[model samples]
Target: MDTLNCIECFVRSAEAGSFAAAARRLGLTPAAVGKNVARLEAGLQVRLFQRSTRSLSLTEAGEHFLREAGGGLDILQVAMANLASRQGQPAGVLKVSMGVAFGRLYILPLLKEFLARYPDVQPDWRFDNRPVDLIAEGYDAAIGGGFELPPGVVARALAPAHRVLLASPNYLAARGVPQKPEDLSGHDGILIRSPQTGRIRSAMLRSGDGRETPLDLRARILLDDPEAACDVALMDFGIILVAMPHALPYLADGRLIRVLPDWYVDTGVISIHFAAQKQLPQKTRLFIDFVVEQFRLQGLDRRFSAR
Candidate 1:
């Protein structure tokens, strides 16, 4: 009557096509496997298999159950593996997928410290603007900016990020800084379209009286890459709305000035995501902890400030 044992018996029977074959795989007696299957069917109040003296086949309901049950078993196995491996020394190649600009600005630098701590760990990093299937592509982890975790993956936030309105000093000097969000309607604005989602995003500004409004700028150029949009803004082409992390260095150097500082939008969280498994591997766990600490030390929480 053990639920796990019942699942094991059911999965093996489905794959082996017979209780006897399943019993062999499970190291249980054929009669035991048969009894477990019957007990499971009785508990669920549904017949899981059609059996005759010569042959065995799954019922339609059993077929559906098997599909769902098999996945659960796989997760159980993965969890066990992760827990067993946790206490051991982390080694081997760790595959990481991440967004290009953020990875370059944030994650890549942290890798040096991680590698120094775990000399045996080697990293395989892929940076792209587009999203990749972590399970399908066989990546151990991914750092990305988004609230929505892809299905079948577990995510943990590493840092917070916000979208802010930014413009070059020269452009602001020429066009004159907008005292209010509505004033953006008279200015040239650069829009950033996400390559992965193809969604356009702009910054909203708030006034001293707590009135919030969206800036309506003439879209002089539209680009999918945020860094490229920053480049365009640097050339004094138009105002750019970008994540604070991406614009930090430029803003600090006076090349770009943050505008509409009172208003901000959470672009997305920078997070580490992996397959939702019960047991995370030692290497993956170490990296996750390391990145979280790194972000904290970098003062990620205070990266944005109202001007």
Candidate 2:
């Protein structure tokens, strides 16, 4: 009787809520997972789960055993993984998700170097704007902004998710510049509709001198995509709000100029999100560390600072 396999099946089943879901994660049949867990219960002389046709749940004794044994099992598995990874290389498919524009611009460029470093590691990267369910979707990690941190997930902040109002020179000149936040009421605004909430975002901005003002601008155009809003601003349609990374190049090349340089929407931080666990798989850990290092090396945090 492999007690270790039984323990693993028990823990996975407890977290996944059913034998079938645990089997999907463990690459085993539901019957096999159930058999292993049954053997484990028999050895311990206790029933772990109260199983019914509709649902599976942990009993009091089962919960106690899981609480006591889960961390130990994780440590043991991590130790084994560390040893295996040292022998040759960390070899596995690392599935990750990131925002489309940001991923294509920054993350995609770094993959060649990452692959060169770990030839055995395969990268399965999803470039998307839609927020993902990390655990339910079986992703190793995810990166972006404003994602709800589900239970048993953690985040590492890579950059400030600071947003700035932007407008092309022609638009500003023709429409008349908004000298103060209150003055934006008369300006043409291209607003971003939140994909998650399905509502148009109207925000207030705070200046360096602690002056906060509500933005009551008229929305001539509303869209979900930030990049598209930038394009509309470039076409001299209206003022649009965009992230610093997306707006900086245009600010430099003079395609777009800041509408309120000292004022910005303090959205939050752009974070690399992953499952919160004591011992992460080697490849996943490496990728998280690597991306954080890249942000530091490139000065993305400072450049995108809301202050």
Candidate 3:
């Protein structure tokens, strides 16, 4: 057995969490994948996986080896891809994850031009509003706000993930505008409850001159998703705190207005993340570069938090 081939099998199986899933990815039978991993274990004289009928997990040795060897294997794949890319056509299935709202409002529109330029590329994009484990899930890249960068991952910031108070003009006229963060307490607040904990997230609102005010959001309508809360806010229900990008269109066209525009909650930066390795597939690399360039052209990359 080729030692590198066995290493590939070991890393893929570890990431996929099942020999069967790795087999599908590697275009091998599940038994062949199992045998390859077994050969690797035999060669190393160590058990790499704790396996059962229902679950598969990495052994302590496996975890340690993956940290060291996974990058080498990925680099090998990148080298191979680089050789193929020398022909000047980047072709492969590009897998990406992004936020639902941002993807729909922003990235989805750019696909036509992206695909037209890289006609050989096939894009598989997932739009959801949750954290993703890049390696474990086998994603090529992800675009969202403030995902933790585990080892083997890096990020390029796209924009400030600033949250602003938004309400429909009708709602503001009806309830009166909040002159300060404290006034939000007197007004109805459409709040975002955490999906994991169901707790309404409290935030510190910051003013332009560096004043911070703690906001204990009083939820008139508590929801787990930002889109839903924004919808409620649009209906003149209450003031909603949302990502600045989400409120941009509404604020521009007069559907919604920003309250205390000088004050915002600095969540973090919205960024695109990818696996960091010595070498990378041309398809993934080119896609990341292109997205950043497009953001620059569109002025979407502006750091609203700074303003």
Output the number of the lDDT-best candidate: 2
Name the candidate that leads on TM-score: 3
- Decoy 2 TM-score against native: 0.79
In the range 50-135, model 1's lDDT, one tens digit per residue, is: 99999999999999999898877866855664554534557767889887888888788887789888877779889987777675
- TM-score, structure 3 vs. true: 0.87
Query: What would you estimate as the lDDT of candidate 1?
Result: 0.79
Runs off by more than 4 Å, candidate 1: 1-87, 202-211, 304-307
TM-scores for candidates 1 onward, in order: 0.71, 0.79, 0.87
Candidate 2 lDDT at 28 equals 93
TM-score: the better of candidates 1 and 3: 3
Clashes of 1: 1
The residue-by-residue lDDT of candidate 2 on 186-296, one tens digit each, is 988899888788898767787877788776768899999888988888899999988887887788899999987889887788999998888888888989999999899
* Per-residue accuracy of model 3 over 138-232 as CA lDDT, tens digit each: 78899988446788789998888888888999988988888878888888889887665688777888988899999755678888888888889
